[model samples]
Target: MSKLNIDQKKIKQLFEDKRSDFLIPDYQRPYAWGEDECQTLWKDIFNFAFPDKELEKFNSDEEYFLGPIVTFENNKKLEVIDGQQRLTTLMLLLRVFYKRLEKMKDENSMRTKQNLAQCIWKSDEFGNENKEKLKIDSQVALDEHKNEFLEILKTGDAKDFKSQYAINFRYFEKEVDEFLKEYPSYFAYLPTRILNNCILLPIEADNEKTALRIFSTLNDRGKPLADADIFKAQFYKFYVAKNQKDEFIEKWKNLEILCKEVFSKKDNTSTDEIFNRYMYYQRALKGNKNSTTEGLRDFYEKDSYALLKSDRTFEDLQNLGSFWQAISIQDKNYFDENTLRWLFILNYAPNIMWANITSVYFMKNRDEQNQLDNIKFAKFLEKITAFIFAYSFIYPSVSQLRIPIYSAMIDIINDKEMDFSKFLFEKENLKTFIQN
Candidate 1:
């Protein structure tokens, strides 16, 4: 927290300056926000500035904190290290207001347009006509999307545009149009609220390292948080704060890179999916019943955050990623040949119950590769898979075997000391695991 050069400024103040140019670095992720994020942000702003009777009466001088933007000045442009997502979304909002003002033909129409222009772009000078403001300098693959972003901002058209930026732009336009329907004068107070009452904490650092370090330390109150994002920021701050050597930082980075690689291969394999599986395995081993996403997120930030903030935690999470990746991509290099063959049968077994359980076991024992661990894991894997298959083949469906099958799985997960053979092998002809 000590390493900072912070400034408390308003959102309007940031855009009013013609010289303000923000440069998003190449390493930064692309604008991946969708309607879920956009809707949430819209609700936040409307509730704050809508002048509803229920909203607390406040003065124009009162500021609503929009969150922080960490960056450093590089020549004339500001190099953005964090808060690009929020800033970009706000810009889209301003554009919607600007467009609305142009169609109104009111006495303050020209003045309002002029003010909105200052927040969006710099006036073109005779000597330099094509200056870039709000630059999203992304990797080559994402470069075209950034270009499309600039185009949507300028034209405010959703046609022929397909990125999340375009979709959110149209969404704002509709929301604002709807707002004007009931409370026509909302914009009159809204613009001033944004300029004078809405806050933007712009922290200026001396270099990229310092900016990133500051970003890592930020709590990001009121903003959407992913476990991986916060974990990276916290771990980076720890690396610098504790004066850990470069070796540790490098290892931590490899974990992040490995996660990105594994996550990028599919659409459904994001943080929630992987983290849910990890949580299931952890709780299942301890016989705990909490397995929902909210449960896992709460557990991570509350109990696990304080305990696992170290180099070793980074290694463990990365290894867990590898375990999930193996199951996801159908690669069994992490398991021995016998276990791999067992997994093959489970995969073709026409059900996913046991496969899910086996994936959790792999995640928990990812590092425990000794003979005993292997033997226990394999037996555990086979017993579960074979029981599922046998139970299905012997009984009709959940009608005859639902309660026993589910109850056994629950008891087995919760009571590790319980006998494995007693509940398994229910039918005489086959190796069933539940009541025949």
Candidate 2:
């Protein structure tokens, strides 16, 4: 909460500064810029470096804004909270330029390589380039990914590596090589233009908490990460502190795969969708159904992210993900035809109010055979479907169904028997309305 330190620096000033080592914190999302982003960046800088007038005519005052990087100082190293994707990609691009330059005997290429070396690696007290270390590292990524990235920088070899880091590095390699071949004279000028003209704004916070809050609010150059992405970091920290991170990672990846295959992207990412469904189940457990629902991030993040800190919450999420995956794929082991028939009807219902209600029921009622309590589940689905359809007609707005369905969800969570006596049923009106 201390006063912020904000500064704008060109790539040269930013990377050549000895005080500015960077670390992608263990909680940050992995580098995710794909080939498209790399290409877009290359094209932008290419156009900037080689304008229609001529490379010699390029304006020194004109700068390509690369965007902001948010970080907090940790042990003299800046732990990146946001903008790791751009920063990482830029480093890869710089390394590609360095590798190509290393092979050239020209004075311009060697001078550019020296500047870039200081950018990519730390210099000794005497200002000699230290090839042993890189200026940035990613603790957030998988071990293999971490190793691959460092290896690429140190050796310029990405053989047999398929991670985004490796892929993007190779992409830059190809682009740089082609640019060199296509415009041999202008090729050396490319890195100079990029290193000296591209602008990156750095926002250094006084603490990690404030930096993360900033990250959650800021959108990346690409899509802001899903709420589940933030939640994953919390879960990862919790498990790692307990020395159970490997197990958690395995389970988390499996859950991601299941949700990706089962959930549609119409509303949100598959992981976010499953999280939303599980949030409803959590709300039901707390007997909180009447008030407006909190956003997926706000709900888990409240009370210092108490929900994600618990093993129970993660287990329940995995269970709910599995349950939905079964339904989505219509796995015969999970539900009989009769229940699925009602499920099909409810799926087409005017609102998704039935979904969480079904989730709560299944969680409380599913059996050891990986099947629903078929008779009870069928009857419950049938009743819920009838309630939804009847209410859809009788009510003027879909919001009117929220409380009743939420109430039903709570009842199911508490293992209470359903009785719609409090509802308007209106059998004659319902029948007449249905007929029309």
Candidate 3:
């Protein structure tokens, strides 16, 4: 494998080889396509295979361009940077075709099955075990689902399988089976068509930066590139600029991994929601009205890289991430009954500016025992939460409360005395902002 290994190959050519392995990295999002996506693909193939007539004739040699896949080949293993969705789904289709052929067991059927199997996996020289050429490599999900996924690939059985991947496989099995009923000979022909006709543009680059640039240039046309992925790449460039690539990568990935778990949809705190909550609080402190109404992207633009020093931004993110993990969910070591009350306030508050403000305070006082006792902190948080809840209900607007609380918190944080009650009393609109 060279530093760059770009190529244009049919699906058959891409997977039907034991020469290299294909892997979707662990950090990438999980397999998330559903019935709608799968149905669209099924329609495309069916329409292309038989344009106007129903099962009239076949052209297995003719190709249908799918799209591009960005990758980097290291040690004969091509890591999929993009386009894993189509590739993984197509692998499911091929698995179905292979099973259909193997059932026939004719001499010709056996040879066809063998060739199609090449697209899915490679057998060991001893022929005891098989390796799937394309691997999803999400260690947890893969470990749980691989045995079942590969079982379906080898045997085509649909027993006790309800995972999204398995469910989609069954869906494809049903659609392809219906099509085969009309054109019974199509089963034998699909392997040839899929291998030779289903096309993809595999652009292998020198590194992740080059591959990400290519990905952005191509896909950014549809969806704007002002999101987290692009922002992450900016940080990567910052690290490279400072000659601290190794340290940045280690810390950044650790934070990303932690965020992924804490902010997963399963946790009922999605990645965006966490960031938005913090941003809401931040804007409130700055007296930014948009904090209550708009998203983080509006305030933290990728082009706003010059607004803050890169290293300071890095440290802020790292510290926030540390505090976030502790208070994210209920942990006995971190969350007490009072801390629980504070969490309830976060869930209850409309603007969540209070959370952003309070979180910042906690980050500053993480090691300070006198000011950060759970019982006292909880009473303080409970007061803010109750006040905001009443005010939001009365006014039905959270945007109004953002500025006052932010100012009060700042005054308190900066005061050597750190008197929460005194700061709240001094602030005008204390009833709507901090008083209960």
Q: Write the per-residue lDDT of candidate 1 for residues 157-194, one digit (tens) a residue.
A: 66788878788998988888887786575455566567
lDDT (Cα atoms) of all candidates against the true structure: 0.62, 0.83, 0.64
TM-score rank, highest first? 2, 3, 1
C-alpha lDDT of candidate 2 relative to the true structure: 0.83
Q: How well is each residue in 232-291 modelled by candidate 2, as lDDT tens digits?
A: 888988998999988988888898788888876743367888888888888888899775
Give per-residue lDDT, candidate 2, residue 119.
Answer: 94
Q: Candidates sorted by lDDT, descending order?
A: 2, 3, 1
Q: What 10-residue stretch in candidate 3 is worst by lDDT?
A: 134-143
Better of 1 and 2 by TM-score: 2
| Model 3 ranges with Cα > 4 A deviation | 1-4, 54-61, 74-76, 105-108, 123-147, 221-361, 366-436
Model 1: worst 10 consecutive residues (lDDT sum) = 134-143
Most accurate candidate by TM-score: 2
lDDT measured at residue 84 in model 3 versus the true structure, 0 to 100: 71
